[model samples]
Target: MADGKFMTAAEAVALIRDGDTVGLMGGGGGLMEATHLFEAVQARFLATRAPRNLTVVHALGIGDKKTKGMSCFAHEGLVKRVIGGHWVWSPAMQQLALENRIEAYILPGGVSSQLMREIGAGRPGLISHVGLGTVCDPRHGGGRMNEAAKDDLAEVLTLDGREWLRYKPFPIHVALVRASAADEDGNISFEHEAANLDAPSLALAARNSGGRVIVQVAERLPRGALKAREVRIPSAWVDAIVVDPAQRTSYDIPFDPAFSGELTGTARAQSEAADHARELAAAQEAFGERQAVARRAAVELFNTGKARPVINYGVGVPDAVAKLIAARNEQHRIYQTIEHGTYGGTLMDGVLFGYARNATAMLDAATQFDFYGGGGLDVAFLGFGELDEEGSVNVSRLGGVTVGPGGFIDIAQNARKVVFCGTLAAKGVKLATGDGRLRVLQQGAVRKLVKRVDQITFSGPQGVVRGQQVLYLTERASFRLTPEGVELFEIAPGVDLQRDVLDQMDFMPRLAAEIGVMDAMYFTAALAAH
Candidate 1:
């Protein structure tokens, strides 16, 4: 080791004691993930059976959907409990939670990130309206995933005749965080990382609780080599440092200068063009249902004639909306923001959902949530798994699976205009699009529009109370949220209102005064043109 604070991954992980609460900092796709550190912990536990019955907490989904990130802690005896913002990325951890082998709780990603900051500052707990009336509320299972999660981590409190959800704080015994590099004196910097997630907050939470902060870095630099502004976590906060030269920017990507804002000028434009070409190709292949929905949603960006509107694109069909905007050369007309805090760039999808190529700026995840919670977004396009007659949308728990609402609640509840994009139904649904019309070849067995959702990830009634303009866009139909309920406003060219839209839904939505047909250009390759 170069110094007392510098050590191998094994040595750093050895400092973690049994039954301790470990806080991990990473988002999906292994952004800022300390893979070697997590692997060392898993290896040590398997060999010695030590560090048993640990409690793990993470603000975002951290994994490659296989054996990395939270999966390394999936061993039954290794982890006794898990409190996370999202769970779908790590199927192994989800399995553990599903089988009731571990106590599992899911909170909103923004709430989770801010709660860590509260804990670090020695606050009582996080008291906010972020999760009110949702699963995170004490009245609605209190963010508990399974029967094994019996403890009440959230409570409903009334102040000044207003209801708010209070998320209780807990001590963190160990913080496993990652950054791009660390100085010889143990100051951490995230110069090469895509996002500076909740790493600094987690480190502070552990250190203030009389615990340890172990950081994994790609390389080690001499003291003072890093600029003052580059040092995200000061040396006084970091206890141990583990250098992993092979650390990747993300799960599948080794290193990309575009992701870290290192590319600029013509280089940035060329990189973006290449990425757009590949995304355009992929979008063309899957251009039937989702593409139509995205095209309609993209049109909303120009609604109300708002110039340079700030927008957020959630995963799934909503991500396609950004690509459509780029394809039209209209990206500069809108400011794009991701939950992970990257702004204004070509957003990546799949495992790289939180990152962007040629990002304009990167804010810490907690601060980004602060902006979102304050209604900084002019519009937000999100994906939905279920839409109820009451206009509520469910994306968290679907088909007997627990896919926690990552940042859906925070963004949906605050954005001035919320547009949800998804297929009318899922599982075996097929469509054919040509000649400026769409034909549904097969109906899906699953009806996404239901009488009631499995969970209330977005409360339609609450949105109405806040006076938010909400719209639901699907392949064959479009609906707007009214004071009464969902009202159908548009249908596809080749679709029948009764058979294709109404009959497929579980309940009847209010009919618009005058229903219109969606633009035909959206159904063909002409959608790429302005």
Candidate 2:
């Protein structure tokens, strides 16, 4: 490459070759903005198949769909495999893989970053205790390599009662990065870009792997002032720079990916615009004719004197639920905690760094588990992939691959009331619940809430032992899991009794005396509009 001319994002990405494993710079907290670079990767991937058998490591998201970035990456099947914390908000990639549209693997975000570091630093693999005893647990196969992916997942092993995962060394051919500012000499500054989880380590990884490192900077500042204090990635690690002055011109740092999406994408922005209308309608419907009955039922469900204010939210409805709880003036009493450095925002490696709000207490994951182990959580609102007759919830294992247990067990074991939220059945299964009835509009060969789950994300035996309350909330009805199984409770107003609720499941439980209806707010405001 000659020195005189600047490279456009499109031109710079032309350097990528097939069979190359690229180490990207963005790791969520806006470390260096990866959009320009990620877009370039997409452009290159879509134009031709030259860069097949590629590997990716960096802040991860699909960009379109319910999750950000899916519109580009997941839509194009560009993600053969993904190794990061999660794209919880963007489940489309996982969906595609589950349906065999593409290949995918879910890994611990921190571990993914570590593995890249190992590869870049010319090391063999990474060792950690994070995924032990969970799906990441090697006993279940440490992790799977996607069909189109080039590298194998690291394996887990135990030495002297201590467990670790072994990821062999791999070569990196390219590194895509985002930076705050840079000088002519190639020194990079992430100045305020602290939100990127592990960008600093990634730069070294690319350089260590003998790969070219490309930086996408928001602005170009004079080279001299980017002293050691400001310099995050030195010029030695950088190969090219794509300066885009039209963007906001500031590194996103490490704001929560959810917040970042709130700022960047269109679907999220549309939802934001509809927030007021949704809220107004939700309030109106909630306060409508059946509202009192619903409220009383909702209250009685949690009227147990043992209930606490601590709140645990699954990834799907977390943003809305947390905001609802907070806006309801309950953040103070309700303990809002996520399984990370901060709470109240979605966490996906490289996507979100931390929530904008102040986390009252920040506990190391282990200590946080201590709270979970003791059954300290008052209620948990989470998403579910499927449930069986035994009332077992599956959120961990999806598709044919695995996304090891993150903090699901800890939360499930400790939370008093665990609420699973999502559409009742997806894909080929069309479902509606009403009048204690289950109706199948388009019969699926499979039911998401099954007689038994393939692998247990949350244990029914454990829930029984703790005598905690559990609820599975869907669009049409709610299933309350008692010791005997799930008892049919509230039904959507227009829903039928036998067709919508009862007939759909494999098992039948004794009806509970009372079950509260979901608030109309989420349906009208969040769901209908979003």
Candidate 3:
């Protein structure tokens, strides 16, 4: 207890030195972030211009798309390099990566989380097939984001006559993490947080490497109050603790005992207490087009005929598919899983995506990715920002923004059947659907179907090489990928082939002699009946 010291954020941040590699912890919208610590570091840099040119590492995106989390360190000379698993939440950081002002590297979320553990255990590096044929593969680009990213962090080698990637490790000089409570001994507990994330692993990596572990927590308790089993990071691994009494569980949720499993109640009580009806109504109102796409995709899922199919849905438009499944009361028929280790239960939309309403069980994030990376999902419904003539899908970078692939590469590369979902275009696009027909009210200015994508997050050519089934679903038409290219399989009724479909695309698609119309039921009364 005496060895662990309570310190202010400024004092804790002062431990960082210039050119050091600092490890961070957090994810999008789940504000389990060390906000106070980030502010202190930012203030220190602004006031004294010290601790410049440091390398930052994180396994997840840690901001609110504003100046809240990692954006605090977005100034020049503060961060020289960044190695992250995701990048959508932090716009400033992404801009830096886009402009080549800083070196950027994006890796799979599972690999980055697991890499910390390997470093803690004194391993040479991580060896796995998680990023075999994607951009993360050394043969491709080794997870580089821009011209500034040139270091060979990954290497390709054969294992058991099969290709595998080895992601090299680097020394961690400091770790910045968040927790719910800390005892006098500096034992941390995340009893009011959503997920434990990588706090324990990050601490071990920092402490073992003779680095400092700085933790920000909500409250401080006596030594005997926190049980040994409840302590995620022991006093031995923790060096300093910073208390932010006003810390909230997330942006909207200040405190929810249920999130940390500290509260228990009847399932009926939990269900009755939820505002699912309100949330569902709002989602339906705001996601009409997405709901239509989901209805069609649901039919596709139903037709797959796989018994108890295990399905994974990505965020955004594909999320409507999960909502549709729940509305149909078909959750039991399909095993819904996510990369966050949540299996079965209602998948929440928006900022609360990583958590489930009534999760059956929760596994470590890294463990869940291992399942996905090894092709455990029967089907995956993912959103795409761009679809190319070669059938490659891009969701990572678009329109000069660097939104790294969080889990798209792993899920898309390994899923048995992938159904890419999104609108034919974005921004101001309008559509009308009713009575077994669909009509375009107005076309969007930005077309999603392009000649070539800015970046290839899901390689359609690779999927074809592996004999995987790939389908592209839109509000108007659907296409299937083959060895030759994209082939038009179905079109919506009341839509012109040349004006609404062909004219919007950059390249011509192979068409069958008899192009079929999408089942009218998808556009009309079938959705209402469900």
Q: Which stretches of candidate 2 lie over 4 Å from their true place?
A: 1-7, 24-33, 44-49, 66-103, 114-142, 145-154, 159-171, 183-194, 224-237, 248-312, 334-380, 389-392, 395-419, 423-447, 454-503, 508-530
Write down the worst ten-residue block by lDDT for model 2: 287-296
lDDT of 3 by residue, 300-356 (tens): 676566888888898887888887777656778988987766687677777676666
Over 107-226, each residue of candidate 1 has an lDDT whose tens digit, in order, gives 899998898889999999899889887878878778888889998778999999998888999999999999999988888899998988888788989999889999999999998899
Candidate 1 local Cα displacement, residue 197, angstroms:
1.1
Per-candidate local distance difference test? 0.88, 0.55, 0.81
Top TM-score hit: 1
Model 1's TM-score against the true structure: 0.97
- After superposition on all C-alphas, the RMSD of every candidate to the true structure, in Å, is 1.5, 8.1, 2.6
Mark the regions of model 1 whose C-alpha exceeds 4 Å error after superposition: 276-286
lDDT of 2 by residue, 1-530 (tens): 33422367887787777657776543233323467766666677778744665555443432322423333455533555555445443466656655655545556544555566666667777665444443454454445424443344667677897656675566767777766677878788754342443555666777887777877776777659677866767887787888766443223332333343334468554544454344435533322212222232233324546434666655554444544433343444445666442443322222343333223343333345445556666777666777876677776666654444445655665677776666555668654432333344674455576777766666665566568787776666677777777777776655565665666666665676885555544333222212
What's the residue-level lDDT of 373 in candidate 3?
A: 76
Indicate the residue-level lDDT of 91 in model 3. 88
Better of 1 and 2 by TM-score: 1
Error of 1 at 434 (Å): 2.3
Error of 1 at 412 (Å): 0.8
Instruction: Tell me each candidate's TM-score.
Output: 0.97, 0.62, 0.92
Ranking by TM-score: 1, 3, 2
Write down the RMSD of candidate 2 (Cα, Å): 8.1
